[model samples]
Target: MIEPSDGAPPDSGMTLVEVLVAMGLFGVLASILLGLGLSTQAVTEDTRDRTGVNEEARIAMERIAREVRQSAGLDSVTLPGTPAGHTSTSFTFWTDFNNDGARTNTASDPEVMTYEWDPDTEELSMTAVTGLATVTRPVLAATVTSFVVEPRSSRWQYDQVGGACSCADGITTWRELDNSAVGNYNSEPDPQELRFADLLFVSMTVEDGNGTQTYSTQIDLRNRS
Candidate 1:
């Protein structure tokens, strides 16, 4: 080895101080990289979970809409909305699965269907009733937050030939009647009221550890003015 004129010692390996400083810097860089990696993983997992929740909610809504679109008319819509009645997390209607489109809910052929969403169980269930046998089954097991059923009903429009309002049958405007904020309908509606229910509105919400998704749609009944 060659030394400078004023050099006291020759070149050597790294000193203890240099080694310690290098190690500290390396440790900090490792920690930062690890933190960034963990954060990215967390975000990816959250996105996946949220997407799953949205899909589940969508499927459920579609199933309900499909059945309701083929329904004859509304039978019973639970409380806390129009057609007020005792509070129940369920709605009953006449399914036109049979050949006839009769809006009847008798215990004869299991044509009557009821959809119930129990908040306590966080699940949706369906019950079909008939004189012979009554069948009940689970529709889906989801974290449902709310399941609301609303009726789109209407009354006939009277004569407007001379700006005169007539209750007598002339021509059907097919406009919904605004009797009250809640309407003059309720559970166990009369035959006329049942016929008035031309549309069924359903809204649902699903909430899980991931997030919440709301789905709503209005389905038309078979009845036409």
Candidate 2:
């Protein structure tokens, strides 16, 4: 047994081993907290990127679809030039601006709307041609990788009254108007046939810092009877 002398001071401070152990525990806790904070920040950033990309795609697709649905027909002549066997990265259509059931070609009646994608600038733009002299252009979306519009037509034969023939005797299949070629529709000999598109397939791809996202939707023409 060890007895302290009357004059010796009592031990009041921690030993070196105790201090070292405390410091090691503190270091471990600090490392764990830092890792958690980093992980949370990374997750938040990823979520923000995804949300931004999705919103961009949604807005563009919705705008196109809304206009297509309200349109009375397509305008093939307004599209830009493209090589043979390739689809034009642009689309143009006519809508009854006055909301009349029938299409009117006047400046204030039926409006021509054109959507063009610029590959060099990665921008999707829209142009509105109301009359021979009035034109307005706006950028619809940015950071666009690709924009494609495919028009499909019904193969069913129609009678003189504009009603489809008997299904059993007439063709009932729906066929691609441009034969799966982008610019073929615009180059068709009869411009009148381009007046209506039974179904419009809108597809767009957008890229951001996070990655690329594609959005697609089908729009049925209201006045395509």
Candidate-wise lDDT, in order: 0.65, 0.63
- Give me the overall lDDT of model 1: 0.65
TM-score of each: 0.69, 0.65
On residues 49-157, what C-alpha lDDT tens digit does candidate 1 reach at each position?
Answer: 7787788778877877777777766666654433454445677776766767564445666767889887667777889886656778877556777877766653334
Q: How far is candidate 2 from the true structure (C-alpha RMSD, Å)?
A: 7.3
lDDT: worst 10-residue window of model 1:
172-181
> What total of clashing residue pairs does each candidate reach?
2, 1
